[model samples]
Target chain A: MLAIETKQLSKSFWKNKVVDNIDLQVEKGEILGFLGRNGAGKSTFINMLTGIIQPSSGSYALLGVQGPNDSIKKKIGVMPDYSSLYGSMTAINHLHYLADVSGKPVSRQHCMEVLKLVGLEEHANKKAGKFSFGMKKKLAIAQAIIHDPQLIFLDEPTSGLDAESVIHIHLLIQQLHQQGKTIFMTSHNLDEVEKICSRIAIMKDGRIKKSGTMDELRAYYQSTITVTIKHSPIRPADLSTMQQWLEQAGTQLDIKENHFTIQVESEQKIAEIIRALGTYKIDIYRVDVEEPSLEEIFLEE
Target chain B: MLAICKREFIQSFKGIKSIIIIAIFLLTAYYSADFSDLLLSLSDDFTSEEKQIIHTVGISFLIMFLGMLFVMGLSHDIVNREMHERTIRFLVTRTSRTSIIVGKFLGIALFWFVCLLTSFVIISIFVHRFDLITLFQSASLAIYYSAFTVLLSVLIPKPSITMFLSIVIGIAFPILNGWVSLTSNVWVSWLKYLFPFYYVEEQNYSFLVVLLLAGVMVGIALLVFRRREC
Candidate 1:
């Protein structure tokens, strides 16, 4: 079964159409990254799917359940972007209370374990108000996963975190993904999205402009691959001969000192270039191929 | 529902605001009890039996007004604080909005009930007699005001505005009661019913009436809150 499906899903605030008609779907066990610019209705769309706000039009279903089913809430978890932990409650107490409300069988031991997983076991007795920003975010994650949900929505899970905290959250996401839990994440961190997301959908003006894997998106854009070659030291006359040979083959190349950077359409083209160079009796040092970065592809669209 | 109620009840007492409010209420109740005795002594127009009812009525008025003042202070921010702080999003996603409204109302009602009981015990010691009817009346009045304040908390966007508006309306209606009585017009006379204290007046006290009013206010709050977005 699909983890989430929406058909013409739309939400509006009075005359302002925050999220226009949108059709989206996510397969089970897939880590789908949702990306959009500010004021592009990402939060509104998530809110509608989570049942925090009713859609003005269209429909959506989560895990085969339709429209804010209470029984299905147990199977889904959410870490909202702007949520605040209770100031006076300790971390353990907060988790325990949330676990009970979310229909989980909460125990002090279990709560401590969840806190430990978030690197907050030692601070279990500390009030949430005393926690730092990174700690509060960890608490939010712990609350989201306390029920061991089949699916989780993490809105900006690594936003505003230090490098270490970001790495910790990324590791946690990897662990959850390895356990076969589906994750729907929204983030401005393209680098992290590229690292963890199996599929991605980019939204613009309340509409998805593109959705696919990184390779698929690159293929759709028909971006060229960059091939870097390090060749043995050669005389200036040898470089001229090599440039004429490349012109005869109609290959695009840029030479800088001892290295050559070639833009090729395919691996076959790269092999052809190497074979052509080999015929010139030029000794080769090494070759490295680079694919287009997600950031580049994202900005291109 | 029980989980939400339990959380709210426990959290209500965890803050210094609750302690401060309780202290202020206790001090006010103690002073009012002694003030009633002194006022009754100056009024020789009443016999000893009438003096007891008069003194009891004086304290009852104190409870009705002071209890509402406490409600306005304590409950104005109950719902809006969660919204302003963005914590309601957590509860709304996991539980029904109706449960949040009802649970929070019950929790605050519980807090106000305990405060009313403590105030009653202190006043009883100074008055030298336990007036069961007065205690019940004051307690119900306190609960009713709390319910109204809860409803207002859901309606208003800010706590300070809710408190200001509630106090203005609370004081305005009673002062308008005289204007409402001077006119013989049926509609104007009916305006007297608008005052929250009208139901808690000397001859108008009834446990059932107070409960019904509180229930209606809470029911309306639930319906309104269920439709509100986080």
Candidate 2:
């Protein structure tokens, strides 16, 4: 079953459409990465879905409940792009307060578990205002899932974290997904999204340009292998010889700075190029082949 | 609702804004020796009639200041803090908007009630030496004024504006009642019944009637606030 579904959801601020008509869906137990640049309406779309801001038009449902429904609110969790916490309360107090307000029977044990999950057990007694930016972000996440919500909306969860913290958060998200939680998150870090998300939706200007499973998206935008070869004492004749070899093998080649980057349509041609270069006794210092990354696909679009 | 209320109560004290207001109130009330002495001297010169007027005016001013502070605190607590901290989105998942509005109103009301009660106890100790009847009258008036002020806090979006309007209404209504009594104007006499301050003059009405009136104002405030966006 679909955990979340939106049909032509749109939102406007002062008559300027921030989120245009956009249809989106996430299957149960799926980690869907919403990729977009800054000011690309990624946060706006998440806000609309969570009912922080009502949509201008269209409809959406969470865990089978419709929009503006109080019951549905209980089934979801949201970590906003910015920190929203009571500064005077300690980190543990903040989580407990949210857990209580969530109308669930929460205990000291539960609060401890959540703090541990966020790696904030030591800082739990400290006031939230004294926490660093990264710690505050973690506290926000801890509050979001304190109710054990079935569905979660996380907006740029790893934007400002150090590398170690980023990895820790990613692992926590993975653990949640393993426990059958449905997550919908947005991020500009394509590497992180590509590493963890089962499906991705690329958005631009309040519209989704493409969306599908990673494999499906990769298949849609065919992967090209760029083979960079480093050679010494290269001359114009050597470049001509490389071009002829590439042309014969039906590959496209570009050369600059005594190096040739050959674009191979398929991986099968990679072996053919190696064999041809071996026959010519050309001094091949190194050969590097790179597949098309999500960054490359986004940039190409 | 209880859970939401508890959260609000605990979170309220954590805010620096609330602490500053309480600090100001305590400093002004405890250190203003001249004002306290003036109140004592005025009570001595005045007969029961003038004492009643002075007590009403004094308690009304105190309640108005408390009311304004409470209203501003609650408004900033409910609207400004959420937006400034960017926590509204996280809160939406745990509770409905109605719950938030109602919980915040009640939480702030409870806070004001405690503050007013403490002030009333202090004032009572001072006035008890003057006349036992005047002390009772002052306590009763404080209770009534606090209730009205809390109602205004819930209804108004801005604390300062609500404080101003509530003070004007509280003072003007009683003066208007005195004017109508002297002029013998039929229209004015009939309209005086509409003001709550008029009811405070004689204190002859049944306790049930006062309670009923307070309930009605609070109910109206809740109805209007529950429907408000954000």
Candidate 3:
């Protein structure tokens, strides 16, 4: 079953579309990366889904419960981009207060566990006002997941963290995924999305430009193979000779300086290129082929 | 809701505005000794017929100052400080919006009740030579006036606005009431009844009016907060 689903959801502020018509779905326990550049309606979409703001049109459901349902709210968690903690309260006080309001039977030990998970155990008794930005972010994370919510919406979770903290947050997210928690996180960090997300949707101008698993997206958009040859300086005319041979063998070529970059329809043509280059007594230095990154695909779209 | 109420009550002092209000109240109250002789000398000019009026007006000034403090502390804690700190989002997520608004209103009201009761106790000790009956009457009146002022605090968005309106009503209504009493003008007399200060003059009927007004204000605050966007 899908943990979250939206159909034709749209949101506007003062008749200006902040989030245009959008359709989205995330299955149970799936880590779906919501990728977009800044102001690409990523945060706006998440805000609507979490009921932080009402949508201008369309409908959505959380765990089969429709929008604005109180029961659905209990099953979902949200960590907004900003820290919304009371500055005067100690970290433990904030968590305890939230636990009480959530009506969850959380104990002191559970609070400590959450603090330890976020590596804020030592600072649990310190006022949140004195906490660093990263610590406050961790506190926000702890508050979101304290109730062990089934679905979590995390917006730019790793944006302001140090490298180590980012890795820790990624590990925490992975642990939650292992515990069968559905995570819908929005981020502009393509590398982090590539490492953590099971599937991804690339958004641009308030719409999903493309979406698929990494392998499926790669297969669909990356049909060309690029090879770099480094032996000696070769003229474009000389490279065109190689291009003609590869074209006859059913491939394309782009040459620059001493490098011969060839686009092949299939891996079977690699052997043909080697055989054709063997006839010219040209030294084949190196061959490198890579699928396009999500960044490249997003830019191309 | 109880958890949120407790949080708001305790967090009240954490706001800079609350601290400044408490500081100003304590400082002004303590230092008012400088003017006590002047106030006592003015009391000598009152005839037996006007003694009650003079005492009521003197107590009203003290209460008004305290009301200003209450308004500053409560209004900032409820509206301005919460928005400034950006903690309302976290609060709304954990508790319902109704719970937040109602809890804050009640919590600040409770804070004012405690502070007013304490201040009245001190005043009674100094003025009545530790007479228990005098202490009770003074404290009861303080509580009644505090409730009225706290209600005003809840309705107005700013402390200065509440204080300004309270002062205007407090000073103008009594003069109008006196003029109506002398001239026997029904319209002006009826207008005086609309002001909260009219109810503060006599202890018997005024207490009931104060209570009813507090209840009505609280209900309006809750209803307004229920449908509030954030």
Candidate 4:
């Protein structure tokens, strides 16, 4: 079953629409990264899905449940876009209370295990009021998954964190994914999303502008493929043959010392040039195909 | 619902509000019992049941005069505080909004029950007998205030605004109630019907109306809270 589905979902404040008419779906056991700039309606969309706020129009379903009823709530977890922790509560107490309230009470030992999963085992007894920003973020994640929810919504899980904390969070997310849990996360860090998300959706001005796998996006926006080849020095006869083949593709190769960088229309032309070079009896050292980064695709629009 | 209720109830006792409210309640119970005792000493024909009734009425008078104010003061920000802190966002996703309102009401009502029971224990120390029905009435009166506090917290969108209105109503309600009996105007006298003094007589049935009012307020609060955006 689909983990999350929305059809023509929209939310408007007064005259301004925050989440425009949008259709989106996330499959079970997939980590879908929601990407957008600031004020891009990412959080608002999540708020509607999690029942924090009702949608202005349209409808949604979570795990085959049409509404945010008890079954749906018990099946999913969320870390909201704001500070959702109680200041006076300890990390363990927060988990314990939330678990009980969700009607899926876990053991204290299990709560400790969840704390350990997020690298917060040492601070289990520490009050959340005294935690650092990174620690608070970790605690927030722990609470979201404490009930063993099948679908988890993490809003900016690692927006502001040290490199170490970011890595820790990334690993925890991956671990959760490994357990067959569907994760829907929103992040401003494009590189992190690129590194972690199995699928991605980009939002802009309250609408989804682009969404696909990295390779799919790269292939769509990538107009020219740049190939770098390191080979033996070439003779004039071999050079002319290479030049003729490169010119046929409307681009020429850049030769510096022992390496050549050439732009071609597709991967087929790269294979043709490699075969041509081999026919000339040149020792081919290496060939590299540069795929566009998520940053590049995100900024292209 | 029970889980949220348990948390709220436990949290109430963690700070000084419980201690302070209980201490003052014990003192009030002591004074009320002492005054009733002095009156009893002046008379010899009154039966034991009559003595218990007098002592209960004396204690109930002070409790009724201050119960609404105490509950409103303690619980004025109950819902709005969660909204202000954004913790309600976490709760809304885990449970239904109706349960949150009802859970909070149960918590506050339970706290009031404990406070009333303690004061009754103090009053019993002097009278040599416990008044179970009076404790029930005082506890129900406090629960009535608790219901209104929940409604106010849900109706006002901001914590500051709710707190302000709770204080205004808490102070004003008792004062107006004091004048409700003395005034000759029909409009002013109508409010006495809302007062516990108008209902808590041995044979009066109007006390049930207070409970019915509490039920209606809670029902309205549940409806309002469900539509609120966390």
Candidate with top TM-score is: 4
Rank list by TM-score? 4, 1, 3, 2
- Off-target runs (Cα >4 Å) in candidate 1 are A14-16, A230-259, A271-285, B11-17, B20-59, B119-136, B173-185, B200-207
Positional deviation of residue B142's Cα in model 3 after best superposition, in angstroms: 9.7
Q: Residue A157 of candidate 4: its Cα lDDT? A: 93
Each candidate structure's count of clashing pairs: 0, 0, 0, 0
CA displacement after TM-score superposition, residue A112 of candidate 4 (Å): 0.8
Q: Name the runs in model 3 displaced over 4 angstroms.
A: A223-242, A245-252, A255-259, A264-287, B13-65, B116-195, B198-230
Tens-digit lDDT string for candidate 1 (A94-122): 88888777877689999999898888999
Clashing pairs in 2: none
Clashing pairs in 4: none
Residue B187 CA error for candidate 1 (Å)? 3.4
For every prediction, compared with the true complex, DockQ reads 0.65, 0.42, 0.30, 0.72
Indicate the residue-level lDDT of A15 in model 3: 74
Task: Give the per-residue lDDT of model 3 (tens digit) for A157-193.
Answer: 9888899999999999999999999999988789999
Q: What C-alpha RMSD separates each model from the true structure?
A: 3.8, 6.5, 6.1, 3.3
lDDT of 2 at A240: 71
DockQ, 0 to 1 scale, candidate 2: 0.42
lDDT of 2 by residue, B11-107 (tens): 5566677687556545444433226557758546766665544533444455433533444433433543464456655566577766765565566
Residue-wise C-alpha lDDT for candidate 4, range B1-230, written one tens digit per residue: 89888887887677686678777887778887778868788889987777657776655866677777778877888898999889998889999888889999999899888878877888788888898777877776887889989999999878888778777887787778678856789867987776655565553455677787788999999998888888
lDDT of 1: 0.80
Per-residue lDDT for A8-33 in model 4, tens only? 99999999999999899899999999
State the TM-score for model 2: 0.74
